[model samples]
Target: MAKNILIVCTSWDKLGDTKEPTGCWAEEVIAPYYIWKKHGYNVTIASVKGGEVPMDEASLNPPYLTKEVEDFLLDDEAMKGLMDSVPLSDVKGDDYDAVFLPGGHGTCWDFPDNAELIALLSHFVDYNKVISAVCHGPMGLVNVKGTDGQPLVAGKKVTCFSDAEEVAVAKENVVPFMLETRLKELGALYECGPEKWAPFALRDCNLVTGQNPASSARVADLVVDALTWK
Candidate 1:
């Protein structure tokens, strides 16, 4: 039987400072989706608002876009599902083997504060399954509390969209709170490379995370490894 994996996509387009036309880095969602499918894992997507998921139009073109994305675009039914994804509340914690979050600026808005997301991830962590995310998706880690009532990320080493990357994507003056700084405040031991957009991933027991869109597939691979290793 295929192990079930849930990938969280962003429903919001604009972030705190970014504009609407700028949305999720399509690669973040597509890369992992492609990898997991090839690896024979059952993947489902849930969005914060549960409506149409916005795609970064810019990434839909050229070498920035991979062949897998082109195939997904051609599959009308699959594209429709991606456009109109299920809401988080409709997803049950026990239905999945692990949950993965792909990131973009939109995650800065819809992901960090969703109560349902907090509940889903909290439950996944509680059950000791793999709870993984990349880029801004790690913000989902912000609100989850362990049964002990401590921050789920407390004392865990993690990585997410780095401050430098956000600054590079949207000028330093525009982006909101630095992810590194905020995770640090929650007692998460944050570490990363000297440059932004580097492939950085961490696994704290079953919790896996990657630094940015570039690390999406790697994070998914790690998630699969964790599940099989179990």
Candidate 2:
């Protein structure tokens, strides 16, 4: 049977108190979606509130926008699927082989404290199912606890959008909390690429994580490989 994959994205469209627009990073979700599709996985899109999920306008501009993102924009079917993502409340971990979270600054505002999302992640962990996230997506895992009542990331090798990268983007102060710091505080053995914006990902048992938007495709590949190997 084809493995079913759930892709969760942030529904928040605002960037902190700056009132600037932000949503799911286009490349972060698009690159991985196509990669998994190419590997013959069934992909489904979901979000906190669902319906008309927004793409960060910044990620759609030059330098950040890549062929994969551009292709997703031009693909009507894919575009529709993204715009019509299901509500997170309607999703179940048992129905999917894996769940992936794609990030944007918006995720920092919503992903961290969502009780339902935390429960879903815990479900995947309990079952030893693959759980993956990139950039600020890992914010969702910060509050997830394992069956033993410990932070799921406690002592687990993981990575996410780093403090230096956030500082470079001038949003270090804008986001609700520093993702890198919070992950470390949660006892994640955090790691990052040598330089900011470089592609880096880590896999620890059933959990896979990427450091930034540049690592999205590689993270998806890692998830597919892990599922296949199992």
Candidate 3:
């Protein structure tokens, strides 16, 4: 049977605070898409909202941009998927085997406060389905609560965009709370990469996480594995 996945990406940015326009990393979303699509998985693109996805122009240019992203942009099918993404309110865990959230500061603003996102994640976690996130995408987990009324991430090992990386880009001073600190407060035992852009990931049962943009593809791969596990 073909595996199915729900891919979530960020579409929010706040100008100077971002230093650069930031959206879901193309590599993180594209690489994973290629791998899973090749292996015959049905992938769905969704956002906090259900309209046009705002891409980070900076991440789509130069060394960061690759053949895959260019192809994805040119692929009308995929482009349509991005442009008319489903709203989180419509995504149900039973409809997909896995759920993946690619990262960006945009997610920090959008993912955390979305009630629909919280419900979707709670459904995935409750059913033992794979739920994964990369970089700031893990911010989506902030409000997800299990049926027990406990935070779904509580006591789980996870990773996301590090405070160190945010500081290097000069947003640490202004951003309210740090991701690492917030996760800690939720009782999540967070782990991260040794350096800013390094790839780091965690798999605590059904919860999967990645440290930063570099960890995106790997994070998706692990999620696929977790979902396809027998």
Candidate 4:
């Protein structure tokens, strides 16, 4: 059977207190979604709440907007999937071989403390299956506890949207907290690329992570490699 992949997205749409709209970065989800489909994997999109995941408006413009995202905007099937995503509460983690969390500023508001998200990640941990995230997606990993009752990221080699990148984007003060600092606080052996906004991805055992929107395809490729060779 083709491997089943569950993609969890953020439901929150606002950028902190600002009126600026934001959710999953279009490239983050669009790039990886097509990659998984190309590999013949079954992909299901879900969110903290069911239905209508918002794409960060800025991601639709230059720099962040890529061919994959442009294609996604024109694909009715993909649009329907995003518009009618399943609620995380309705998903059973066992049904998937891997779980991927794609990110944007919206994740800062909703991912960290979600009970359903934590429980689903726990299932992936218990089964020793792949758990992957990119950019702000790693925020979902921060609060997850391992079998030893420690933060799941503790001692694991991982990377996410760096603190420097946040400052570069001028959202350092706007986001809830610094992801790099939080990961380190949780004892993650966090790593990043040589510079900000680069394609950086790391696979430490079954835990895979990418640093930014630019690293989405790299993260998906790593997950595919892991699944193929396991």
What is the model-wide C-alpha lDDT for candidate 4?
Answer: 0.94
Task: Give, for candidate 1, the lowest lDDT window spanning 10 residues.
Answer: 14-23
Cα RMSD to native, each candidate? 1.9, 0.9, 2.1, 0.9
Better of 2 and 3 by TM-score: 2
**Residue-level error in angstroms, candidate 2, position 65:** 1.4
Instruction: Name the lDDT of candidate 3.
Output: 0.81
Q: Spell out the clash pairs found in candidate 4.
A: none
Best by the lDDT measure: 4
Give the RMSD in angstroms, all C-alphas superposed, for model 4: 0.9
Give residue 97's lDDT in candidate 2 (0 to 100): 97
**What does candidate 1's lDDT look like per residue over 115-228, in tens digits?**
889888988878988999888788778878876898888899899888777777763454456777788899998888667777788888898989987788888888878988
Q: What is the C-alpha lDDT profile of model 3 across 1-230, one tens digit per residue?
A: 88889998766755436565666667777878888888889999988777777777767899778888999989999888778988777777798888898876677777887777877888787887888888878889988886678887888898988888888877686555688889989999988877789889999988899988778778877877786673
Model 2 Cα lDDT, one tens digit per residue, 26-103? 988889899888888899999999898888998999989898888888999899878899999999888999999999
What TM-score, to 2 decimals, does candidate 2 have?
A: 0.98
Query: Alpha-carbon error at 34 in model 3, in Å?
Result: 1.1
Displacement of residue 158 (Cα, Å) in model 3 is 0.5
Backbone atom clashes (below 3 Å) for every candidate: 0, 0, 0, 0
